[model samples]
Target: MLKDLLQTNASFEEELLEEINSLGKIVDFKSNDILIDLNEQIKGMPLLINGAIKILREDYNEGELLLYFLEKGDVCAMTMACCLGKKQSKIRAIAETDGQLIMIPISKMDEWLAKYPSWRKFVFESYNNRLDEMLFAIDNLAFNDMNQRVKNYLLDVATINKGRKIIKTHQEIANELNTSRVVISRILKALENDNILKLHRNEITIL
Candidate 1:
């Protein structure tokens, strides 16, 4: 897996990759597993080799807001931030699918930053990408209506799954969108009425 990942990700120099392989350990997670929770101390940075992880933020009212996903070949900028600043994680990370990752120790973060130009570039790029995703989420919450948001969410799911068929329940969508199940059901019914989609027991087929 490391060899294949290295073929595409040129950010890790051969020497750095050797160091990483020696220091880091391979870890696996099952779907829906909570990898990290709010205010938890981050021990290492997870370099995702396959599968997906969802990043979420919780409100004071116990509501959860979906942030963005870290998929194959992606790194969690929040984890990197916590590792660098020696702080706790402000968001939660949950495995979206069974996957594996290479967990690099926090101690190596600074050494690589100073020693490897490629590593530094990769970190900055990851940060910028995450910032953009957050901004997009903020824009949707602040500006878009519920209907539009739901549609956008479906589109995103379709893209992630690489298909138009979204296999999820209305309640699941509600939880991710931080809304009531009743509201989500109503919106989905409206979409069905408009012939925009076909809703089944727990699946939605986009038209």
Candidate 2:
């Protein structure tokens, strides 16, 4: 279900899948695999077939910040950096789970762009959409308080799971929101006391 949402559209059926299967190799990665490093030259595109991956930047002193997460059927948006001919990536990608990706050469993608303009447009839109998401995250961090930020993060995750709640550790939630597990625990306790949410072993349910 989540996978379908990531791959949404007819172009995957009409163009992407067949073309990918024809030329590229499907590569597998274990959890924590570094798909690309900061300052590395832009390669080609990777079509994620399974599992999840995160793209973020690690500053020498400022620490790490998440940029995005690409799950099953989600194409790597960094490929668009390559499309735009960017020299180096500002973000690095790491596998959040063991996964497989269809690797396509930039040269081949250029050929496809020339052959299928509509497919190219779809790919471009995917990148732009990702850019929008990044901007939103930045806005949240800049304007929202830590409590509101954490609350909003949980709400977003719940909405993503269709309001069923998220089954993840406090540390995981903290990592996603770029905060401390202790902080998250305190916040959760406050919310629980207010009868607003319930916490299980590692999950949270909105009440």
Among these predictions, the greatest lDDT belongs to: 1
In Å, residue 80's CA in model 2 sits off its true spot by: 2.3
Residue 120 in candidate 2, Cα distance off native in Å: 1.3
What is the C-alpha RMSD, rounded to one decimal, of candidate 2? 4.0
lDDT measured at residue 89 in model 1 versus the true structure, 0 to 100 = 96
Worst 10-residue lDDT window, candidate 1 = 1-10
Compose the digit string of candidate 1's lDDT tens values, residues 1-207.
466753435457888888987998989999889998999999999888887788999998998988988878788888899999999999999987788888999999999999999889888888998999999999999999999999988988777767889888888899889999999999999999999999999999999
- Local distance difference test scores for all models: 0.88, 0.73
Worst 10 residues of 2 by lDDT: 1-10
Model 2 C-alpha lDDT per residue in residues 49-137, reported as the tens digit of each score: 77777777776754666676776656656656664585687777888668788777776766677777665776777777788878877
- Off-target runs (Cα >4 Å) in candidate 2 are 1-17, 28-34, 40-42, 83-86, 96-99, 158-167
Model 1 regions lying over 4 Å from their true place: 6-9
